[model samples]
Target: MTKDTTILLIGHGSRGREGNKETINFAAQWRERHPEWRIEVCFIEHAEVLLDEGLDRAARNAKKVLAIPFILNAAGHVKMELPHALAEARQRHPEVEFLVTRHLGMGREILAVLQGQLDQQIKAMSVPDPMTTGVILLGRGSSDAGANGELAKMARWIFEDNDHELVDLAFTGVTWPRLETVVQRQVKLGMMQIAIVPVYLFTGVLIERIKEQVARLQNQYPQVSFALGTHFGFDKGIFDLLDSKVNGDIEEGGMLECDGCKYREAAEEEHLHDHSHTAIGGGGCAHGHDHQHEHGHSHAHGCSHKHD
Candidate 1:
């Protein structure tokens, strides 16, 4: 890639204007924050600016364009579609160098953002001790077991490091231990207060769904109080994470290390569950994307276990 590189941030477009606006604004903030680098934003679908248009804009003065998928995980779009789009762009502009950066996956910065949100929510509860509080991490579940497994692992890390009594992992859709089951399990475990932290980027339908589910749970268990934490938005920490990526500080080689992936053959034989996949990718905005990777397991094993 050339030094005169324009960072093209690709967002999964949304039907709602607010979603689109937020996505565009994130890129705008990045540009203002890092004035030295030339940045442009575009969407895969349901947006004013498309990928091709963003590439054209980048080609004006930039010798190379670094197309970064501003997504949370390495879902379908990152694995296949984005690459396909970049491949097409390369064909169009043969002279201009086109490179694809790694998607926003498991990282220290992301963990920091989650931890910050969790701590803020826990403080608001005014509970006598965090040891009595149970945490329910809600994820946008994917058919790809690998994606679901990643979220489960993060939940374990959170539980182990924090003083919370128990940390449970659950998904809003497509996988096991749905929101209700996880919440009920915590209640059964005699947790007085449960903190529901949504592992999402940006406000969207899934976040709303989580709120609705929390409300239902509150109604069901009036005695047990529930607190729904904020989603990961265009925070400064997130910007710092992206900045590191743009500066070539992120290592992408081990981005998808599926050593014991159930979907793939491993040295240790582990029994895997049969999961039904809908399509390559679907939905726009938030955690909606293609789940083309090898999904490992339901992540049910990690739930309800206290990590000391």
Candidate 2:
């Protein structure tokens, strides 16, 4: 990466200060790792230096800008909001080339990090019996079914490799199979030890809520051992993944996955009547071209033109 290029690190801002602080700290550490490249951090909501301002700052003196979403899945924010922001930024700064890399989706490195967390938690147990333990991989659920499905798939992947008796998927909110429901089911199934692992990137209000939930479960079911796992914060594995994304072969353009994306499907269906859908770099807005979609109706996930 050249000095003229600015790497814009975009995070999904949280209501809690710790979450926002983690993002800033991550950016600072990344800067230290690569002092040659200019990096700027911003949030999508609920934090300082919003996306627009961050993009402006990045485009100020840079010839090219790589906007990377510091998120886990290709949900609403990544598919709709971030792309819209990039499109607006391109309109504002036509001189600078804006490209967005893929979000931190499910990968082997992520699985390795999660496996390490699970191993640490199980190691701390008095008698870590895989046959008697139940692991619940919790996710900050989204309205997007594809995103939720990704979490479910990740849970299965963990279960397949680990020696745990059972591994199931649960969500904090906005989806079915909630944490409490899963815990209840696991307790009924004679699980002596149940570990609730959060697949979040940073410490935030949601993490606190999960901790409180674990405590409540402990009180309710004194016989069952409930252990709350840690979120991925400043993990070297995550840093390496981000480094690869930034400095990898996606310098010219990055591809965004639109598999099972509601917006893309709706848009394609609409375009079939008037104009043919021109697929761009495997369904991504490379040069910030605004692909307008007509959301004539709403689905259970609340289909909208803008994902807010």
**Winning model by TM-score:** 2
- In model 1, the Cα lDDT at residue 87 comes to 55
Cα RMSD, each candidate: 9.5, 6.5
Question: Model 2: per-residue lDDT, tens digit, 1-308?
Answer: 88899999999999999999999999999899999889999998999899899999999989899888899876667766666577778899999988888888878888988888888778777757888899999999876666777788889899889888789999999888999999999888889998878999999999999999889889999998877888786889999998998777363444344323455555444442111112235433221113344433434433223321
lDDT of each: 0.69, 0.78
Per-residue error (Å), model 2, residue 162: 1.2
Residue range with the least summed lDDT across 10 consecutive positions in model 2: 271-280
* The best candidate in terms of lDDT: 2
Candidate 2's TM-score reads 0.84
The C-alpha local distance difference test score for the whole of candidate 1 amounts to 0.69
Compose the digit string of candidate 1's lDDT tens values, residues 1-308. 24588888888777768777888778888778877788888887788888778778877777787777787765544444455456567788888877666677766777788888888887788854776688988887776655677788788889878888889998888778898998888888888889888987777767777788889889999998788986676878888877777778433432222211222222112322222222223311112223233443333432121111
Clashing pairs in model 2? none
